[model samples]
Target: MNAPMAVESARSVATRFADCRDRRIAYRELGSGEPLILCLRFRGVLDSWDPAFLDSLAKSFRVITFDYSGLGQSTGEPSYRSEALARDAIDLADALGIEKFAIAGWSLGGLAAQVVACLIPDRITHAVLIGAAPPGKVENPSEPIFLERALKPINDLEDETILFFEPASPESRAAAAASRKRIEERSADRSPAVAPEIYLKLLQDRAAEDAFPDIDGYAEFLANAGIPILVITGDHEIVFPAPNWFALNRVWKSLHLLVLPQMGHGPQHEVPEMAAEFIASFVRHRSKSQPA
Candidate 1:
């Protein structure tokens, strides 16, 4: 596989907006190759991605990161449903004149990615899920403390560390600090943080009894779609443990799972270069395996 380019800070990339339906979606593009759309995690804005991770992926492919509707610089009322978010992603891709692309989604974004693969199987060439919550009802819900912290306004870097990393490890905590510094690099024209009300609404929606249903059907849909999928997670992920994704292996015909040791919920941020390498390798392998 080709090596990734020199690391560039994500904050240095120019932000652009695309008109999709009635909403304007904010996004950033880097490097150049087959387009790879990165769906944002819950309450995440375009500026939240780890720069090293973005830069690494950009070396091998066109990387596109965008904010969801009603979040960050985008203008629209945000919806809590994953299906709605998936539609917004498709709309943004359409507006950008991108007919087909690979997708990488983290946390809640992963859920939306799955829905997208099902909705537009032909358009999505590959799928990557990182620290993603599994489809259907969550047998092990997020801890009360974590949920409470996430709903509260982020007062500073400490809050972010608590929300995104494991507190027990100094290494993980250090990684969180570095990630926060990178996120704050773009001081001017930065996208606005997600509003508290929107965050609460999303949490409420996820907590609903029917938040996820018919998981088996969703799994079968992905299996039939036959899209290559890469699932990565930290072994210590508190929000959605790595084992949670193992269940999909039985149903997803083309799935590869990677669990990094001594990491937390934000594995990409914690180990950006490694995560990028895994992603690039997966795409490269897929490309080679395809029939000419």
Candidate 2:
């Protein structure tokens, strides 16, 4: 008998493309069942995701990861704003004939997730925000060193350690190294790293130092929209602090917050299985908060 030819996982999955809104969006999907679209963080591409995280999520949800229009492996007139990114997700869904599904985003992509959930709450089953920020003013904003490092043409292991992991904790730093290895394990057909010029312009033009810009009216939708939201964050989040979520406790009708200890912005990468379990359990049980 012949051995399995391909592993149904991120490491060896082929990149697929879909035409949407005059652009070709590059994406990859694995597993089966409920559709769950994942939005990448700033400077994040398909390869940027931790394979362990993707594999774990794949077990339950048909996790879809894609590049924004005109970024990474996608093609079309490029855009860097949150709404543009959200539109990309919506377009991809339409192209794939996926009417309703769950949406998850990290970092800047979190903002895009919020936009999609709010714009079409009827189409979203659940909104998952991982290391994502809330709408409105940023309370805990980012540190200068973050932007300084982000502006670099290329990031090294040390930069990855500081950017995503909690440096003060040995365990977190060690996890960061392992995550980096898993991400790079994909040797062939990897999505290109987002160029500094493109992602940098987003920081300079729209976002301020260490803070994600606010989109007007999103707060009200979050406050009243019957969407169940699960926000996962690390205890020591430098990019968008965990406390920011606390500032709005009970303010959001259906909110479940999970703060992992000794973790940073990339909690999913730090403990992929643990984070994936939380997501799987959350999505499986329907909340009464859904709009009827």
Candidate 3:
């Protein structure tokens, strides 16, 4: 019953690749105990994760994160669909000899995590969705201005602040600044930047997929899957607001929600230790309640 150890910076974690199917997936593994695979947000590479957040989770569980097929150092064409990304995750876990594990997906990654749970119910123990848009039609799509600002080349700290944090809140802005510094800690041996064409395609694909009618079935799948789920969000997430997922409380059989006040899209970055401790506790409680 002791507290988990502090996680080191992402720069300190060594990068490795696993050969899965036709692609070589670039990934980093940290911590120990049960495995937890984290999926990245849109156009995000392995480096996009917050170091302090990853470090905190690594303190209790073996946290593994990777670039999708065509992103970062991974080789292959970038997939536009969440299902395709989920398949890559399964492949990576298989290559690593992991039989069962938990999954945490952020933003677009959250969509993929739901697909993973649905497709392989027996393989996943717990699921955590952070600032994630629910499956089905996106009622509150991101503003065009926000996407325009985010996709542009990173010119200054202001650029990142606008993309990930709230401009109006001083506290949110400061957290975004700290998170940016942590991401920059790894200068040498950094993963490749996402290609412009690939990034655009991902955005297009997300828009197209969001229009599909069948995407709404994901909620039904999760309700019946019997897996425990933890949904984390910032109260003021401009892109994917907290209330969207909060509405799912009526349907999701085993659901837990955490909404950090005065935060935006990246709540984990704003409250890394709190988020990590919640995940650890959720996973531990679920494990104990499951049939042995």
List the global CA lDDT of all models. Answer: 0.81, 0.87, 0.81
lDDT (tens digit, per residue) of candidate 2 on 198-218: 776765766553344555678
lDDT of 3 by residue, 1-292 (tens): 9999865567777889999998899999998999999998877888889888898898889999999998888888788588888988899999999999998898878888888887887999999999887777666766565677767755367866766677778987898889888888887767787777777877776664552234647778787577898998887777777777767786777778888888778888877888899999999887513421
Best by the TM-score measure? 2
Clashing pairs in 1: none
Q: Would you estimate the TM-scores of all the predictions?
A: 0.90, 0.95, 0.91
Q: How many pairs collide in each candidate, listed in order?
A: 0, 1, 0
Candidate 1, 166-193: lDDT as tens digits: 7778998899999888777778878888
Model 3 lDDT at residue 272: 81
How are the candidates ranked when ordered by TM-score, highest leading? 2, 3, 1
Model 1 — which ten-residue stretch has the worst lDDT? 283-292
**Ten consecutive residues with minimal summed lDDT in candidate 3?**
207-216
